[model samples]
Target chain A: MSEQKVDTRLWSSKARNLSPYVPGEQPQHANLCKLNTNENPFPPSPKVGEAIANVLEQQAYDLRLYPAPESDDLRASLAELYNLDINEVFVGNGSDEVLALVFASFFLKERPVLAPDISYSFYPVYAQTFGVELVQIALEDDFSIDPDAYRQPCSGIIIANPNAPTGLLLSLADIRKLASEHSNSVIVIDEAYIDFACIDETNSSTQVSAVSLINEFDNILVTQTFSKSRSLAGLRVGMAFGNASLIEALTRMKNSFNSYPLDKLAQAGATASVLDNDYFEQTRQQVIDLRKSLTTQLTTLGYQVLPSHANFVFARPKDGNASAVAAKLREQGIIVRHFDKPRIQEYLRITVGTQAQHERLIDALTAMQTYSEDSETISNMG
Target chain B: MSEQKVDTRLWSSKARNLSPYVPGEQPQHANLCKLNTNENPFPPSPKVGEAIANVLEQQAYDLRLYPAPESDDLRASLAELYNLDINEVFVGNGSDEVLALVFASFFLKERPVLAPDISYSFYPVYAQTFGVELVQIALEDDFSIDPDAYRQPCSGIIIANPNAPTGLLLSLADIRKLASEHSNSVIVIDEAYIDFACIDETNSSTQVSAVSLINEFDNILVTQTFSKSRSLAGLRVGMAFGNASLIEALTRMKNSFNSYPLDKLAQAGATASVLDNDYFEQTRQQVIDLRKSLTTQLTTLGYQVLPSHANFVFARPKDGNASAVAAKLREQGIIVRHFDKPRIQEYLRITVGTQAQHERLIDALTAMQTYSEDSETISNMG
Candidate 1:
């Protein structure tokens, strides 16, 4: 409320008018399922810790010096991983910071940018922060981002791949069409959950990245984070991949803002994460497998779950009292996200955790159902 | 140059027109005196590494989860050290990021803001980034800020205390008068080098922080960095101290921008640095002592050094060919900053390193003078 409230005396008009984005609660408590924020249930790779420790051992004294202004090591690693030129990579504190710079760099034009209404909540907040005009198009009834919905002349367009809250993927073909259609404007494909989109119909993890089309369409920019997939949320590293010119614009803006946004430890740890292919492969497949199992279990519990292609699932309970189920789960030390927003209010977003964690959740839901049936029978007898 | 070159296609109008800031070089060479960026020569507090190592040991797994959004641990330590309420402190990726948000939160108004023309160069860049109208008032003839020079109506005011490049300090009396005169406007005091200002005429760092004025003047905001004083530039920790309301606005803007700007290692390390008073005091005192000795040596070597209250000194050589001297020093693997801007083109801003490092610089400058005279004699004889 303080963010929305206007204070004329000292606060800037921009600060007073801003509706700050509220990230999911990073609760400090223990003994809960803690699936609210879409954090990977598994730990980061051992190589990440080893890389960080190596920095401390070697450069504890060099910590007095500033990090390399351009974060060359991290950018080089990201470039190698994504098969991009070094100049085409830009690294920031997180995907959030990367997107903020993107908005500042490519979207502050005369025309309004287009976004899906039921996408990442931070999109609108960024629009407000940068004073960029945003036009939000509604999703289809199935919570799928319709490629044809963005049918307007715009400065730029942004869509989250395997869109948040509702975990549904937009095909690369649709993305190519959209990028080709809007050749003059920048198209930001936020792939925060793309690593989790590996679940395909063939029981194999499919590649859904739009990075392949970056060369064909110079206007397309892809943003990804270490938080969800690499499991380095505590490290704060995010990256953007685009053509040299667009990435140059981002670098210029980044230089103007904070030249050394990625600290030394972050550069080292994230670079190691990118290089450790086997660990990344094992962990990503595990999450994908866990997601499949969780989806089947949720459907068995009579929840109308969306076909999730992300690390989280959005589901409506059998009784349609999603908030009640979430609250009941919380009472049993399990936490899930229940949005108070429009249209999707009846759905609860649950992060896919390990197998044991999913079992705990399923047991709780079964008990709740049994109790509900008993109460219904008692009420009928009365 | 690419930053200033405009490309209209696919770039935002803002990005097209941006002339981003150029930071002092963090050269990758070895065996150089390396004083260009004003980083402290010594290592950070030993406790900083311990704290970071502890985080990696304890929460290597927890790194999968997001860092605390508010960076409460770091802020609490800062508040406790500053004798302010917890809500009065704010932390960010670095002082650069903190100032960037400050510009966005407080200066984006109809009224133009005032800044010293000779202050930190990034101030203008931040102004450009946020589209804030910045009015640069020229400094005094002696390269000092005249507090009374801030004459016009303005939204806010920014001044680097013991100002950058020149290293001049404004008296607390002048600061109080300025704050009193501009009660309605927020006055930002960037104390990036304040900790090095410990050298008083009585040989002590007399309390120079405008933080002492924060409770008295609700409009005065003071920003300090771990980069210069704590020797944690690689950690990327910076903080702002102000009244709760001003800090609240900064929080709103920061939250709107990036909630987890400070990573887990940064928070833990910075907090430990604050708590380790002995390490901070010892390192700070060493820098002050080194600065004092460096000043005497430069003065003895016929350079007109300004009375520096910072970790670095601004001095003009006898011949005033700073570029020539800098070039000579570079050939011997020694580097110092030589700004080519008007009014200060003849000066070099040199960071105070260890005793031996300063001696190397003095010896090099001494050799340069002797070589110059000998070359002149040969030319004259010919």
Candidate 2:
């Protein structure tokens, strides 16, 4: 009401102080190479489309009824995929939702929850939203997590494996050590990029999912999403694996928040994608290959590329102006992420796009280098 | 791994004390008359299916990308429908999620929020989830909200118009009074059943929506869902309308919780449903007709039916055994909701179904009455 003069002072104190999570840009330009967000470059499985079409055609009437509250079918598929009991799995709108619930259910304590200072940015936002105290332990100079830093007493712990903006994976042994040490606290291993980190092409046995450690550590929770490897970001499906008691706590949080977080089509499509193992393996392998090629090319160009296990590579430019390089790439219709954080300010996190997109990025960088050399010669003559 | 021995004591104190809201049963049998949850008896518009199919066919690759973080297109559609600015509307996975954010945003004050004693059961669960103190204000003897009672100072207020399980509508004037009285606090009017409460058959002008008061009262936030008259419960889309500042607060809360709460297909389908006014009005009018007929029949069968302004009718059986009657109805493959709570335990909330389903329910009730009389005579003779 313009006449009434709206007042924001009525908002809760937490809302006033809230610094919301800024997700990666979703550029509207169709032709632009979108590498800002770590989305899969390939399309989702054909079975996902078929499953959604089937639901629309046959069960259109049932859209009037609420979806399965617990997303039982989706959970069952995830359980089968991970070789876990159905009760040990929990599904939500996305991995973000699952992680948010974990923070609310397990970490809201008088003591602070421990997390890497430079991990997924959403962790701190969740902590703020839930009124949980968060203690940020800085990553080492090499952008690797120091497990010793997490040994102190805390309410809980969360680590994003193959952490965002760093693209570095933590070893399973290190994760197990942290979980074992935090026996009385809930430890969350956010394995959103674990599928991309699986390097053995000949066998699936090399997949290093924290889900394996669930049975060994009662307090450990592993969260994953379909957005990355499964190529279902638009569908909004994510899952968490843990002991049944921990899963039950997340379930309670979800039910209290929104009874039917997953819609019928999301449940159907996500379940189909999970069952399409061949498609999942093929796309992830393609991304993995591209990451290796891109890393080699960047290294040849005098960039310091981090050893990345995720779909994206975190590298600093030779000139050390990450923001300027990101802007130049944007001018050429290529969008890559550049975080302005303290330690990661000089690095750009680029998603592994298709071969053509990668070539475009290389050409743009080469041209920029040539132009800079020409400009230096002119300045020297003057 | 199995020898580690899990412990439940590690769960946060809040999670341990949580009593999650239980949604209505989604029966697996197709033949049962599901008058338990207040779902529309008709299918959604054919355009909804077409819209979803179009998205799948054209932008299947786009599923690899995250959906619009704010659901701007869907929110724009809702804004157009309500004749309000886009900034005044906020969309979520469902009205439940929207309401949950409202609780976390505006009602988490040090003082206890005020709510009607006999209303949607989820209110208490949300209060507990957000750690907000909630004070229950007793409804009038006729189960209507009294504005005078809400006049007392409190942090915020949430009232369901055409309240659940009671199906009695609160006048817009009363809602305006409460909103005006609580100028410094948010007054939420959940208009989930407003479409069914449009009692004026001659004109649309008589449809009572708190949205009208929004231009006058800055504190009134009206929440509605596509799950009701629009027949999209399975898709899970809901919206809230308020002043820009209040909407901004909700957006902050939503971004902090889950960036993309609405999926791509959900956005497409819900937008199409909002545009299909003919389908929406037809199905709601059909339900309104059936509700009147059902009420008359129930009264003849010795039931005191409440004056309903929703798709469901609330009534107490003359025999004063609502649980037994509900059990009897279930035996006949007819399911209705019966809440065993204070002040309303004797009532049965039956959703208004199609004509054939209503006939089946009436026939079942007649048979039960005859059987009861026969059993009573046999007992007397013995």
Backbone clashes in model 2, listed as residue pairs: none
Candidate 1 residue lDDT tens string, B1-382: 2534545589887887777898888788778789888999889989989999999998789999999899988888889998999988999999999999999989999999899988899999999999999999999999888887996799999999989989989877888988999999999999999887753645554788899999999889999999998999998989999888888899989989998998888889999999999988888888888888888989888889999989999999987898888888999989899988899989999998988899898888887776778886686678
lDDT of 2 by residue, A1-382 (tens): 3424645677988777788899988879868988899999899999999999999989999999999999999899889988999999999999999999999999998889999999899999999999899999999989999899888999989999878879888989998889888888988999999888854534534958889999999888999999999999999999999999898888888998999999999999999999999988888889988998999998988899998989999999998899999999999899999988898899999999999989999899877876788886686668
Report the TM-score of chain B alone for all candidates: 0.96, 0.95
Candidate 2 residue lDDT tens string, B1-382: 1314534577888887888899999989969999999999988999999999999999999999899988888888888988999989999999999999999999988878999999899999999999889999999999988899987778899999989879999998788789888899899999999888865644544859999878888889999999988889999999999989999899989989999999999999999998888887777778888888999999999999998988899999997799999999998899999999988889999999999999999999878887789886576578
Show where candidate 1 strays beyond 4 Å: A1-8, A199-205, A375-382, B1-7, B199-205, B375-382
Count of clashing pairs, candidate 1: 1
| Worst window of 10 by summed lDDT in candidate 1 chain A | A1-10
Chain A TM-scores, candidates in order: 0.95, 0.95
**Which stretches in model 2 have alpha-carbon errors above 4 Å?**
A1-6, A199-205, A375-382, B1-7, B199-205, B374-382
Cα RMSD to the true fold for all candidates: 2.6, 3.2
